[model samples]
Target: MKRTLHTVWLVARRELRTRVQTRAFVLGTLFMALLVLAFPVVTLFAGASNAPEDELSASDSTTRLGITQSANGLADPLERKAGVDRPAISVRKVADTETGKNLVREGELDGVVAGTPTAPELFVERHVFPHLERALTTITYNNQLDAEMSRSGLDPEAVRDRAGRGEVAIVSMGESQGAADGPMAGISDAEKAQRLIIAMISTFLLYMFLIMTGQMISQGVVEEKSSRVVEVLLSTIRSTELMAGKIVGIGLTGLIQFAVIGVLGFTAATATAVLTLPTFTVAGLLGWAVLWFLLGFTLYATMLAAASSLVSRQEDLQSVITPVIMLLIVPFFVGVSVLPTNPDGTTGTVLSMIPGFSPMLMPMRLALGGVPLWQGALSVVLSLVASAAVLWLGGRIYSNAVLRTGARVRLKDALRAS
Candidate 1:
């Protein structure tokens, strides 16, 4: 047992050292790390820039002030006030109502506020953005309410006090309802959005990294076989040990890179409060991502390793492994795209349970804090079992085909070899 492990370690360590020293590996790893660091930062900035914008042309300065400065000048709060996303609005006073209407009709402005504060008429052909309409209604109603309050002999302070009293607090109770207890529970809308995006991005990374890394492993097989390196290594170590070592070595490199990306990206995002819910925790999701990455690599790397053994030359590599690549890539995209909206939905749940898809799907579900303990456990077990089976199969293929140097060895011939 020790000898086998030592041989595996020797092979793994050599591969790791060799790859790490390469300029391509170093540069690529650095590039991916930078991307991870940039993802959340870019996401936050993009959200700010992408907020819906509404431009309203008012009749005059007074009307524009009424629209923007109503509700005790509480129309625009730069910070998130009550967890709802607010759009950006700019109000400009025009020379006349007709001009404002023209601007609106010509698409220069979103709408025109022409009538009085009490009975303000928002003139627009179509209400494309709801935020504009809400802003108009809110300002108009506040101005009207203030007028009614003034008529009732309440001073500005008293009107403010009354309005303050009208602002009822909203309490989100999920404990009793059982709606918020899972991944989505107790998290703010911002947090939910962030989790979804993070999950999606992580899924993308997994897909990108796994497929690339698996391809590298396959290419390594072809390279070693074509160059007759495997024959030399075969004299000293068992094929199983060599195969195990290569997978482990390559997997470790990928894991380290993955860890750096996940940890740094997640930490930066959380620190920036990019999608922070009150109960937004990172450790759990981090573990989930790393675990799935390992499992995903196991399933893919082994199968790809076995597939590569079918072809001796590097050029014949693509044809042999294309199906395997597609099998993993397709599910990864689907899991990332669809799981966020319905983390606990039927499609996600089923996919997460299946072996090939589980590696990607379950992590997405985990990222959203939506996966049940049982589901996660089952996924891990299934993936591990599948990985073991594939690894065994791959070892057999590698052992059988690694010695063959001609055209691609048929699967039947490889399996029948002693």
Candidate 2:
């Protein structure tokens, strides 16, 4: 066991060294760093430049603060008080229906409030965004202070006092399924939002890495085969060992690249205040990323090694790899689609169970607070078993055909040799 591990490590280190030294790896990593950094900078600029105007525009600012006329006079001083220091709020006594409609269309008033002893009725043409709409609602409610008084069964002044004193306890049973004990059960809205952002980022990275790294492995193999290097290497090392070394080496290279990109991205996000330092615990993300990365590479690497054996030339590489590429690509789209609709849906559960898809699906499930301990354990076990099978079977094919040249190797020949 130790010897095998040492061999894997030696091969992995050699591969890692070769990959990092390559011009393509350096350029690709630099590009990723710039790309990730650019996003936060762009977002910060957009947010800063697009600050809400100091004054709501005349067309948009015109809002009607409604009042009810009692037999004696206007109900309360609430309308005037609510609009204090706010020039945009215009109090309008809606004595007639026609006057209200006309004012709204002319943009002379943004909305209408039918004031009663109860809470006023706000009639806006459309659902306004929350901030402005909130201001309107508060002003209207104060103008007709009847409902709050009735609900509290207290004097108007007492009702207002209690309303002011009452604290808002917003409890969100997260996962959107109303399930208790979710990861978000005790978390605040801000933390929940942060978790959501992180989950999205994690999913995107998982998908991106799988696509990019898998292709890199396939393409690297094709290049080596086309250049006739595999023929020379075959004499020194067994085909299986050669393929294993390449995959391990390439996977290590990809992991290193991924780590660099992640660190750069986190630094950029922190500097921009896009992600708070507390929100970006490296240990947590690295733990998850490393686990998923291995699972993903192990699941796909053997296929890549085997597929490369089918093609002897660069041009034929695409055709041989097309099926495996399609398989890998399909999960990304399927996982993405399933993530939103049912984060823990039947489809997600099934996908999580499949060794080939467990890497992507399990991380998503963990993020969404859907994975159970037993299920997670099962997924790991299944993935290991599948990876072992793939490595053994794929190595057989690779060993038989990697030495062949001039034409693509047939599946029958590979199987027969095996």
Candidate 3:
């Protein structure tokens, strides 16, 4: 037992060392870290383009405009009327209508308002600013409505009081507001983006790390067979020991890389949260991401290591391992495309319970705050059990077939090999 334990550690250590020393591993880790950091930075700048400007301006930034005396009445009396403060305009009385029109044309005035109190007209060089037009129309209506109402023998103040009192307080009911006041209605685009970013980044990295390390282990196994490295290693340790050591070694290396990227992503999420980009609580999502990454890596890496032993030549690697890669990839796209909108929907619920897929899908659902503790715990337990079964089968296939060479060895033949 002691010798076997020592051999596994030896193999794990060798694989970890060999992987870290490579230029590709070191550079790839940094590149992925930078990619994680870039997400929030891009999000920050992207929102600015859609933001409203701080200062509102119109007609060369002047708030003062001219009002002309019309055929029916002058605009002066309504200019100082009470109880109106919206769309503020400073009115200047113009003696001559044609002079006011020329002032607007000469850019000395914003525009000239000329007409009866009931029907007002604003003249600018070519066109009036839309907001200015609306404001002029509203103020004119208010001024004319009161006078018009008084002339009809109605009490204007009493009518105003009745109109203002008609406003009803709307309670947040689904049918009442057309979903405007629902529980989910308050979520901003940034919050939605953050939720998606968390879900996607977690699932995507899991897929990448699992597949990359899995292929590395497959390649390592084939290298051992082709270069007769297994014969030399076997002299000191049994085949199972060598296989155990190599998988553990490569897995530890993959875990370290995964952790680095996860930490960077978690940090970016924290910072983005300050900018109002909501994330799952740092401890909650970060912990699950790391947990799922390790579990996902273990399950896939074991199968990939076993699959590698079936093929002696590098050219045959893709044919044997493509299915395992697809298993990791399918759940990733599902989590990314479907999980955000329907975290607890039919797809997420079913996929999160599956052993292979749960590793990628559950962490996303967890961030969406849809999965309960029992469900997540159940998924983890199933994954561990699945990992154990895969490990046992992987150990057998690899131990039997790692020594064989030439054409690809079939799984059934390898399992039955004496």
Question: Among these predicted structures, which one has the highest TM-score?
Answer: 1
Which segments of candidate 2 are over 4 A away from where they belong? 1-11, 47-183, 277-282
* Strongest candidate by lDDT: 3
Better candidate number, 1 or 2, judged by TM-score: 1
lDDT of 3 at 154: 95
lDDT of 1 by residue, 337-404 (tens): 77876787888898888999998888777667645567778888988999889888888988998889
Q: RMSDs, each prediction?
A: 9.5, 9.4, 11.6
**Model 3, which residues run further than 4 Å from truth?**
52-192, 272-280
TM-score, structure 2 vs. true: 0.65
Instruction: Report clashes for each candidate as comma-separated counts.
Output: 2, 0, 1
Q: Which tens-of-lDDT digit does each residue in 1-418 have in candidate 3?
A: 9878987898889899989999999999989989988876776556445532112231134445687767224344434431132234567888867988888778778678787677777787655355566555667778689999999999999999999987654332111233223234444344456656666767777778888888898899888888888888878788888878887898888889888888777777466532333232545566777788778877888898889889888889999899888888888877778877777688778889799889888888765543555788889999999999999998899888888888899999989986
Candidate 3 weakest lDDT stretch, 10 residues: 51-60
Rank order (by TM-score, best first): 1, 3, 2
Off by over 4 Å in 1: 50-185, 277-280
lDDT pick, better of 1 and 3:
3
lDDT of each: 0.73, 0.66, 0.73
Q: On residues 346-395, what C-alpha lDDT tens digit does candidate 2 reach at each position?
A: 88888977877777777766655535667777888898999998888888
